[model samples]
Target: MDHYSFFDRDLSWLLFNERILMEAEREDVPVMERVNFLSIYSSNLDEFYRVRMPVILALNKLAKGGKQEKEDVLLEAQSLIEKQQQKFGQIFTSKLIPLLKENKVTLLFNEQPPNEIQSKITDYFFSQVMAFLQPIDLSETGKNFFPENNRLYFLVSLTLKDNSKKTILLNIPSNQLPRFYSVSSDDQQFILFLDDIIRHNLHRLFINEKVTGCYSFKITRDAELDLKDEYHGDLSEQIEKQLLKRDMGMATRFLHQPNIPLHTLHFITEKLSLQGSSVVEGGMYHNLKDLMGLPVSLPGLRYSRWQPLTNDQLIDAPSLFEYIAQKDCIFHTPYQSYNSILRFFNEAAIDANVQEISVTLYRVASDSRIVNALIGAALSGKKVKVMVELKARFDEANNIKWAKKMKAAGVEIIYSDKALKVHAKVALVKRLVDGRIKYAGLLATGNFNESTAAFYTDHILMTANPFLVREMELLFVFLAKKAKTSAGYPIEFKHLLVAQFNLKDRFLELIDREIENVKKGLSAGITIKLNNLEERVLISKLYEASQAGVKILLIVRSICCIIPGVKGMSENITIHRIVDRYLEHGRIFIFNNNDTPEVFLGSADWMNRNIYRRIEVCFPIYDQHIKTEILKIIDLQLNDNVQAVGLNENLQNVILEKHEPLIQSQQEIYHFLKQEIYDRV
Candidate 1:
């Protein structure tokens, strides 16, 4: 039996956010990119409160017998968030502000505008921002007011001539207009927040009354959709209804300016019936996420851009099918172009031999060329079946809209089973090649969205291997018929690792094999790269392997619960996390099966939700060349001391000591892929 100790999941996630903040603090990073990291941190926190806090809140409610476990977790999360927020303010104010000024761009927060830009700011406000202002008298509305979720607003205190005061609520039209307005004056550029512009003109709205104070505030509501387990109607319809109710869910965090008076805060909370714990005192500006859109275009202030490399194999091929037929191709995205994956579908749409197209859509781009190709295939009389998962959080509407558009174009649309979400990123194409049906499939570790593909590090395998293609066909057939079957129906996959079927068992078996190899005095090890590692069963297995002298290396990007470097438990295990210009989103697993290693890459992470609840696929890397390429990439990441942080005994992120040459994995991988293109040429 493996006695296990686990880090709290939410706290582990917060540590990842801290790593992001550390990037912002790095002097070597470009100034604007540092500011962008701040935006990313703020945005991540908003989502954490929206999504994860509700679960904690529910657990708190369910702790009926005075059990404070959930409450303690929430309090710890709150404390950690507060500390990070302070660090954010310090970095922004002390470091980034000076850097921006040196670069001749000014980001004005709560200060008075310079004399040179005062008139321009006033003129721009009336011309662009005045029409969107609608101030509600909060005293008159009393308890009847509700702020929209995540929207920025201001609470104003007005002083009248009769020595009386009134409070009003005004919405900052950030959604309708750009949050940062750029103005150039006297050869210097100025970026002002929409909140500041509204603050400057608060008196203009109330002509008779004097505006005493205007403070920014925003509420993050519970974003969890309340979809019941048993629903009679369509899942898409149910999701649409739930999405509408999402905005009105319980307020998880009520963030107000720290300078707001105690009386005002009390009145506001009382009016909204908010609990004391829900109120969080924040900065003068609520939504600092707007910093990402700061209109500064200085050349050296941003990170040097690199164009995605064109895959050598597909660049000159007459047809993607022909190119993929001769050999399997792997696309390492953001480093390599996503065009190869796009071309795969584009060719299938136009190819005369193509007869069937099937793919799973979890979250797609708003203007997806993949969907366009599927529509084209359907219109051209080819059989097209798309399983669009409508339950992808925050993307439900976009997925549903695209599903309708494809359905209107005569494409067969498949909705996922209500009990499970189809999280796999796999596609299958059948073509009549030389009078026989040939299968070409796409299995990826990321979504099919081109927008994210440009910046998310993922792997896509385009292959014509019969064994994998046959299994992919079976998986899609299972997905299509999943709604009609009983819950206990077994799906046996030989070539693929699928969740809720054989994925967990296969992982345990693989670990056990490594343990057996170690027992037999043969070399054994495991290397895994995933976005998260929170499943206790798998962690225990890895611990068992470590106790048996099997080495393990993990590159988990976020939410790692397993504590590495512990004595007698996981001493042989090491965990490294990398955060860089590109998000590390791929899942790659390598097992040293007595020198003849086995490698697999796919969309599934070692998380409870991914392994037991969601429908995911992990496909084997059969092509030895592709497996070698993946191993090389993994080696590059392992050698990354610049952006990689090792997990210490306390699960804190500590910068790995630099070796010679200071290798950054993302840059090195790009160079490696570029070299491969040159070598092929």
Candidate 2:
């Protein structure tokens, strides 16, 4: 109820998520894609429960101990989510299902299985689904029936011959079977939830007992892993132990289908030892994120794929290494193909001249071609060093899997201190050309994983700049030693802004420069694009710059904590939140140095985690062409009316009024680059 200088980040995050729901509401959006938006909204909300809900619950209890600002925030978040869920249901039933039916696709939402498909559904239930079902009676199973976090389960009530009541828990094997079953009859397609198929055949499984009622429910638990400030043994082993217990964590949410009998709800809650505060009422579907599994059968309703553009210059180049050796280049993915980035690592693996390669991977793809290249590079006798952060949340298992594979293949594996995480997306390849140690570096705003690169918009700079490449190598050296902190390390990063050492200070200095230029009556402005903005010190400095008359512009994709456009404090500041088809993942900062603009891009988000807890790299853009292209892209985003929601002082998304030549930044940026790749690259 009270206004603070900064908005609560969690509350701001909830608003950003609501924007996804807004996309789903747009009539112009294709119906199938709209369904995907709904899926994303559900997926994002589930993750919010797993990751942030625990903190909210803890802080609310602590609020009782007098922090007191938000038990208010906790209640507001719950109420907001409740409203969003209702709106989600309305869209699903009234709008989306009607649209689907009009397109000759029946989603079979809350409705029963059509009589036509009953035989087929029953057959599949016995032949395929029955193998995965494990039914446990609550009375007989006693304390052994534990629900895994976020997994869907049906609580079925059965009536016995003796008139005694029984509750049974049936697993929804969505993990093993398709979440939805598609069947066609009378020229219409019906999509059935796997839950319904199993629910329909409940009587067959229970042959004698009458199937009285069935309700869906799932428990979301705290996902936090507690690692000591210092690890005494293997960090991977310690994390593996914690991961086994992750699903067993205390319940943060107990979401159930609406209108279950009160006694059943109470009995289940009591049996599970679920907190009273954790109970949440929901529609029939618990994990609607599985809606993504729905078949996209209509060609007319599907988004016309934008073919990822090719860097024609590198297409026929004899060697990717030699291409970078000629000049510096910036590669954008999903707009520009990720193949060039892939070929960079691929080339290094085979080139006889290449001697060593080093890269820091925060999150590696399950089938990472880059990691495979590293394995080949090591197999070919080239020295390879990789710092795989096993602490990348939700990605620890995949990263550990790759790390062990690389390690087994003789690649040197380096792990950061338990207290610190390596969040940098960078790589260095060294070659012996003409008896000289020649270096080429890969610096990007996203991970090296090609899986995410397909959808996440990120910038990768491929350069042979010795100063920058060598500076990157120094970072790898720091990781090789496994220094816990920057307290004793004396690496003066003149070009790279690395966290725990110079990143925070360097950013402050840049903001100070803009503030001083404003005082000198010169052209002064700052433009930054970040995924999140929560570091208070930097935000305060930006607030100071705004008061000093520096025009500040921000394009933050999610979780902005700073209060923008407030009188005197931030009157000269404006923030835009953009959500669209492709994720806007690049982080770019441009400061108008009087007249000439300076650009920097990297992995850091300016959040508290990035500023103090992780090793992030934000590198300067020295190439004139690269700087101009980045500025053009940012300029388009800043001017965008479509897909851009400007945040008011209250942290509400106010749609930008459309102007002449309406620009959707993602679509326009792609065309702009596609045109350039043909005209200039």
lDDT of 2 by residue, 600-636 (tens): 9999998999988899999999999999999999999
Write one digit per residue (lDDT tens) for candidate 1, span 1-681.
Answer: 346888888899999999999999999999999999999999999999899988877776767557654435777888899999999999999999989988788888689999989898899888989999988888885335788999998989999999799899899999999998889887788888888998988877888999988878888999888889788977888899888899998899999988898899888888876773367888888788888888888898888889999856568888888788889999999899998899889999999999999999999999999999999999999999999999898999999999999999999899977768889999999999889989999999999999999899999999999999998998888888865432566666898998877889999999999999999999899999999999999999998899999999999999999999999999999999999999999999999999999999999999998987788999999998889999999999999999999987797999999889899999999999999888878
How well does model 1 score by local distance difference test? 0.90
TM-score of each: 0.98, 0.98
Candidate 1 segments whose C-alpha is farther than 4 A from its true place = 67-71, 141-143, 484-490
RMSD of each predicted structure: 1.5, 1.7
Best-performing candidate as measured by lDDT = 2
TM-score of 2: 0.98
lDDT of each: 0.90, 0.91
